[model samples]
Target chain A: MASLIDLANPTRFMRLSAVLLPWLAAAAAVLLVVGFYLAWFSAPPDYQQGETVRILYVHVPAAWLAMMFYSMMALSALGTLVWRHPLADVAQKAAAPIGACFALICLVTGALWGKPMWGTYWVWDARLTSMLVLLLIYLGIIALWRVLDEPSRAGRAVAILTLIGFVNVPIIKFSVDWWNTLHQPASVFRMGGSTLDPSMLWPLLILAAGFTLFALALHMVSMRAEIMRRRVRTLTILEAERLDRLAAQGAPA
Target chain B: MNDLIAPLGPHADYILGSYAAVAVVLVGLAASILRDHAAQKKALAALEERGAGRRSGRRAS
Candidate 1:
């Protein structure tokens, strides 16, 4: 925990990520390659959905990351609110767009999967609607960050909204069970048992884990980039101010 | 290549599409990040050099 805290400092974070990015990139490559190969070929087709079942390779993982990324943002929001950690604010802010990307992927892939399997491309089904709402919430957080100019001010405001919006997470989770939707009920992570065969299950599980680590890697890189951007902005502002002072001094009484 | 592509299901398009989409997004992301890092590094280095040059120029007087 102390080491983790130490690394949260931007310089440490940058160094650690520079060292770690290559490994993460390689792992992401290998896992994604193997996972897709197995998902498309080795996994037996759904006795029902047939080949379309392969879409789960992207859809399920994206959906998981969408929600997982939001949870991370909300947690960082909490840290920002409590401790006023600037890096936490930067992380939460940086993660919004990435989470939104995953959420968009989930929504698109879900629709593609549904069109052939559920007989419609768009439905106001519970799961679909809630996931759509998640995407909108991510957008709202991003817009909030953009609208506020002061970094600390924006952090405080988004932290408040994040706490308020945390309720939607559980709502998204339970919507599939609570309503009759064309969407299938929970399969992999649920009570009773995982309905999936192990051959099929292993690939989904690996891809899911890979997506998660991949998201973490992306978030770290993005946050590092954001820190650098903010540093540049500050330097630019300071340089302009110094020039203004020099010009005034040279202007004479 | 046929052996590699053969085991793919009848819907070769969908599998290929997913792979292509992921690759495009990931590559785009890598390129953008590297570009951003390089841009910022060069800008900061330029500013520092200019600042140092001004300081030395003043000291030479």
Candidate 2:
């Protein structure tokens, strides 16, 4: 059993991830299949929303993942800035696009779910607007990552930005509570316990688990790619330097 | 077919469309990550093949 510190090594992380990815992917696939089956076939239609309530299966999970991935990124940022963990920035860089994708899914699905229920596809409500702002923050962080040429410089800059942007997470969560919005206040997770019936809650929980596992698998794959990319960059620079040194020594024409 | 979607009521399009959108986005995300991993792996392999050692003087095996 390797310690967390030992696993922080890029090479070790790569090996561990390679071993873990297949199992994670397999588990995610199975859970998603079961979850979808339950959501569509087993769960009954809502009394109020009717079949449109089916959309909650995908919408809620995507929304959860969008926020969850950002929280993970925030932790990774802390790892980079405070502890200087080797894989921290790699994790953060790999997560940005994935988190952004989940945010996009959340927004699109929410809109589709909204149109039939709320009679409008777009709303300027607190929750809806806050979620959109989160998507923008994700895009901005990604843009910052691209604009910086050096990985270390980009890592530090993006870490600062990610920390600053994290203020929106709690706001997004509490927006419905704080304001009279079309979006319902937290139903599944609340202080007095979930308002949802057990039948509906089961499928939602299962689907959320499936989505989370799938996202984590993707994150691991992306991190492995980032590590390999850095290796390629280092080797290429070394090769160029080697050639230059040989030329300077008059050993090569 | 009608029986299956009938339970989804008149809002069938919204429900089905939401699922479809999620599938597309998730699939696209997976494809892009796999593609990036392949490209980086190939590039790293090429560099190692060229006898380019790591900064720590490690010869990739």
* Cα TM-score per model: 0.88, 0.95
How does model 2 fare in lDDT?
A: 0.91
Top lDDT hit? 2
lDDT of 2 by residue, B3-50 (tens): 877767798988888989988999999999999999999999888876
Model 2 chain A: ten consecutive residues of lowest lDDT: A1-10
lDDT of 1 at B61: 23
**Angstrom error at residue B20, model 2:** 1.1
DockQ of each: 0.32, 0.72
Candidate 2: residue A41 Cα off by (Å): 0.5
Q: Point out the worst 10-residue segment of candidate 1 chain B by lDDT.
A: B52-61
Q: What is the per-residue lDDT of model 1 for residues A1-253, given as tens digits with 9 covering 90 to 100?
A: 5566666888887788899988887898788778877886689878887777888888888888888888988899888988777688888987887788888888877776776677677899888889998989999998999898878888999999987887888888888888887788899989988999998899998898778777777787788778877777776676676667677889521
Docking class for candidate 1: acceptable
Which whole-number lDDT from 0 to 100 does residue A232 have in model 1?
70
In the range A12-75, model 2's lDDT, one tens digit per residue, is 9998999999999999999899999999889998999888888888999999999999999999
